[model samples]
Target: MAVSGARPRVSWSCDPFASRGRLVHEDDAPPRSAFRRDCDRVIHSTAFRRLRHKTQVFSFNEGDHYRTRLTHTLEVAQVARSIARALGLDEDLAEALALSHDLGHPPFAHSGERALNECMKEQGGFDHNAQSLRVLTRIERRYARFDGLNLSWETLEGIAKHNGPLTDRDGNGVGRYAAGLPHAIQAYNEQQDLELWSHASAEAQVAAIADDIAYDVHDLDDGMRARMFTVDDLADLPLVGNALLEVRTLYPGLDVPRTVGEVLRRVITRFIEDVVTETSRRVAEADVASAQDVRGLGHPLVGFSPEVQKAERAMKDFLFPQMYRHARVERIMEDAQQVVRDLFGHFIAQPGDLPPSWQEGRDALNEERLARRVADYIAGMTDRYALDQHARFFDTTPDLR
Candidate 1:
């Protein structure tokens, strides 16, 4: 039960024992705090299991060693926990947020998401974040009483606002990324009030930054492994280049894999240290006394410093051209989009094509409702399942491999 090197739990840390309870109340189990229970529930969910076959950057058929959604979630959880532990925040809450962060990602990664979003453009549009909320609050039917997992308010709030507040004080949308809030988030906030105008807990902030760190680091590794780019090619990029330089200086003529591995390990370590140092400085500078104070500070307490942020942006720019927009990736993603579009069109036309569970009561629903239902079913599919369905429905399914 003891965590090694754990700082005394600070006032700004979300106290799991004092957590805001779940929507549909249930008796608490002994020994495990509410946040701990939430972590377990997320790990056990059917959606979590499907992540093994879900794309992170590549299709499931691409290679065995590539990062899937499940692996990415695990990496994010690891980084989040490390940062949370350093900041004396609730590690379980951070881990839970990290694990649940990608639950709404569709079959073919961003391509599938784009296709779904376009398909539902009239029905309030598709957002993976909103879909994630729907998945947690409505989709996963497990409890005898509640439809979703019925996670604690703290967990839900963390999930809702992890990337920062969605609205301003007058309930109008705020932030550079905020337009109108997603329909799922807006609807849920109406019922539960996740304080859309304020920042989430520090643990949630840690998880959000951890997501950025994992994406940057792991995508680089995957990109290298897939031969989309080379380590030598990245030797001029920002943080990555610096890390590679240090690795080369320390161990001259190391093999390519070991050299790349060292660079990645260093990249993760440097980012974690930067976040911990910057967050500690921000917490001290703001004189935050409680979780509420952390939330109301008008800026995130957890983030990279200016230098690191610049470097991170540079790295992303490098990846956008060298990896994300590479001809091979573009070709496969194009096929992936077509597959999602075809599936949506087919299911909307022939409702019976959906499984019995998805088809249930869909006949009674209106066009928008049916479309949303079909979207949900499609969104929940793994890459293999999506491709298989495509193969079944269409005469020629593109070999995404």
Candidate 2:
């Protein structure tokens, strides 16, 4: 796959991009289109594979049907691909962006991410998006140029921007070295973009929404299976309850299981449709110069329409209050956070425990890189690996390395 810069003249399949003629230039050798290259790099990255073992709220082994981070990513890819295809966007680029969107998420879900962020607070804070960009451009090793994945700027930007606030712009989320680092000021200035730093691609936004859709409904499904909530209990949820009543009234013969499935499916379908329609309409209206140029374009529809948005807001409010905030989930989050914090502390205080690659000098440049190394080690952990590390640190695991 072609690595850096634009390649000219290649035939693009999608509308805006195809209008641009080609994103790759003729001078580029070892030829591949930029978007295809981005897709390949993500597929080959170690971080992408490790996602299989990472938790997506529920543990990987909790049930045969629970979604791991890997499955969640694939679903996002599927959803984004469909939207991209419908909207005349570059499917390869969109799918690549979606598949690698969560590459930097640490073990045990957002709780672990929060803990890692706190641990790195004085070290510039550990945002999974920034870390994912770092992984692609500076960490993941394979085909060699700096021991990193050497991904295209487009893919890296998409990953960093997947959950970025609407105000962010191109290259905005790339990390800047904090004070005391040798080139801190330079890094910050160089990284700053025309807008907010967390900007994601329109395709990335599709993936982000897909992630929300999967987790929101799936978590409720899991809650039911775990007996955390009964059908009656779910029917008691304010928004879901209201929807349930409507569903039952419309289809008197539908059983609770079928009704539950239909409700979630309907919500997801409705939201997805709203997003796709809005995105396509906005894209066509924008008069974009090309598909490559659309990478930094904001989603014309950030979320659902008024009615659906209200229901979605209500659903989120209900989920937070009823499911995520429940004692069982809270306890799991707390445990995961503590485990992450302890592991980070252990690695920092005794750097020798890390692999030899991380044992470099404490010079300013090296210090920044070392801190990143710590983040990488922590970021790469699986839920089980994190638990074992915690156990070893606390003397609960006798045979730990």
Candidate 3:
């Protein structure tokens, strides 16, 4: 029943062997694939571990039960691998991208990123995606032969373009970077072209969507757990509401905790299924032939269906005012941002205050270069470490509660 010369399906997944080699070449260590090595290296990185104390939504002082950056990352990895496996793409590559996605997030998540971006506004701004690339390529020095982990080109490319192309085919900045590219990404692209004009691999796309999924599902869960919202509060919001109705129908008298667990379980599962079905449909529709075909398509092949995307939007619309922008959360985030701002100011005024290692050769740099050096050092701090440093530097620091 099949037409002659027609491909059965679009097979645009990355094959580990076909990867562009690392920035610094090294001999094959064989038993593990390049992507598997990338995952291991990410796990071993100090920046990855620092995520334990970093903010996701709630600060450490707020509550121990809320998700930390590290936990959110693990959830993203799990979702990414599920989506990748379902799509018959490279699961390890997806997982590695998911694990490294947040490595560049400042101590207080988006708030911290905003503060840093403000501090470095003249230095082309601080984009976390760009910082993530820097964390992998420049910071986290554990290699004997190189400054970074020397991950495969595929891994690095995924980290750089997980969200999408940074520029147009002509190398002009696109989207948020319409005026110019971030300094860190631009500097690295000079060393090794991340093909900033094209979409990243299918695996990276998987990681990117997985991040959205994790943020939506988990933030709602955290909101409910914090009592900012209740399970009944989500009883009318499309996908989540449908799940809530199903839970109540199946277990009429279930406790609030049990009902919440069931609803979230269904919500997350539906989101993953929607991704698999929609992405597979797009790939088939596009009739792509190779990984490069996938990348050069100008648009990603990974996402939710229109209906599900609408539902996801509804979820966010609900969360924005009810949870993320809640008075308590705003107050805490404001304090966290001030911590970042204060830390930047303190180090800039007293460059000698920086650790001996960070201060090295900083004397020779011009103003812009010195500011960047200071930014890098502060950007790498864990939330608790940042607070501790703030305490050490000033007479009074914000409570961050």
Candidate 4:
């Protein structure tokens, strides 16, 4: 568990033994801490398996080298674990948070999410963060004792509020959800309070930042794989530009792929090091002594230095136009969105199209209930499965190529 430059466990690190326990109490399964158990549950879940075929930025039908959601999650977990270890936080908690972070993302990346959100606009606008909680607390029905995986309270808290507080001090929705809380989160909060107004544990914050690192690095890799841009294209970029120069200078005349890999490796190192240093400085200066103190700090402790923060933003800016919004990607995503919308419309109109298991119960369910159900089913589909379903229901489905 020891990482280079990492310290022994710190006082503010989340203690797996001191976890708040699961929502539905069960006897301790010996030889594993609660957070470790939560991590295992996520790995064993059907949703986790589905991630292999789900889109990250590229659809499953895209070239094999492109990142899939499962690959992305693995990279995030690796980053989170390293950061957590370096910061003397709970690596298990961090890994659990990272592994479970994207379970709620629909197929076709954000395209499917947008389609589902638009379809569920009246019921409860789909927020993947909230949907993550729903997936953990309700969707995965593996255990007879519980409908969901019944993760530990700490894991649940991180997944619910990992990005930051969902609400302000007054408890109104804040951050990305300023308009109103997602219905899934709101309903779950009534049953088990996630302390929506406070920052999550330092471990949780590590996982969130790890997600950013993964996206910034892997998206660049995928973008290059797709010929959306090249490593040379990042020469003017801030943090990455320096990395590219250093790599080229050190390994003169390296091939494009090796140069890309080396530059990305340096970027990840610089980002992780900056976060560890900045967060350590904050932890000491702020006199944070416990995980509870971390939650109440009102801001994240795990983040890059201001300079690196700007660099991260600059990296995002570069990708937004050069990769994400490339006409090729946009055209594909637009068609992917159509597939999702078509599926939603069909399921809502012909409830019989839903699988027997999905339609087995709830004859008394209302419009909102049925709509949400249809969304859940659609949201769970892999990109290939969705296209398949569309082909099954409609005469002509999007090629999504």
**Superposed model 2: Cα runs more than 4 Å off:** 1-33, 164-200, 231-259, 281-302, 360-369, 396-401
> What 10-residue stretch in candidate 2 is worst by lDDT?
1-10
Task: Output the number of the TM-score-best candidate.
Answer: 4
Compose the digit string of candidate 4's lDDT tens values, residues 1-401: 23466668899988988888888898888799888899999999999999999999887777888899999999999999989888888888999999999999998999899989999999868988888899999999999898889999889999999888999878898868888999888888898888999999999999999999999999999998888887889998898999999988898999999999999988998888888889989998899999999999978888889999999999999889988898988999999999999999999999987999998775877999999999899888999999899999888787776
The stretch of ten residues in a row with the least summed lDDT in candidate 1 is 1-10
Q: Please, what are the lDDT tens digits per residue for candidate 2 over residues 1-401?
A: 11122223222223322222222232232456667666777888888989998988676656767678898888777766665665545667778878877888999888888898787777677777666666665567675335455544455555654555423234223334223222222242244331334344555566667667667667777677766676677675545666677788889989868988877665556556776665555555765554344544443333455665676676677668677787877777787787778887787777788767666663444555666667778898888787877787685422211
Best by lDDT, which number? 1
Q: Give per-model TM-scores.
A: 0.97, 0.77, 0.97, 0.98
lDDT of each: 0.91, 0.63, 0.89, 0.90
Where does the lowest 10-residue lDDT sum fall in candidate 3? 1-10
Q: Global CA lDDT of candidate 4, please? A: 0.90
Once fitted onto the true fold, the runs of candidate 1 whose alpha carbons sit more than 4 angstroms away are 1-4, 175-179
For each candidate in turn, give its C-alpha RMSD to the true structure in angstroms.
2.1, 6.9, 3.6, 1.5
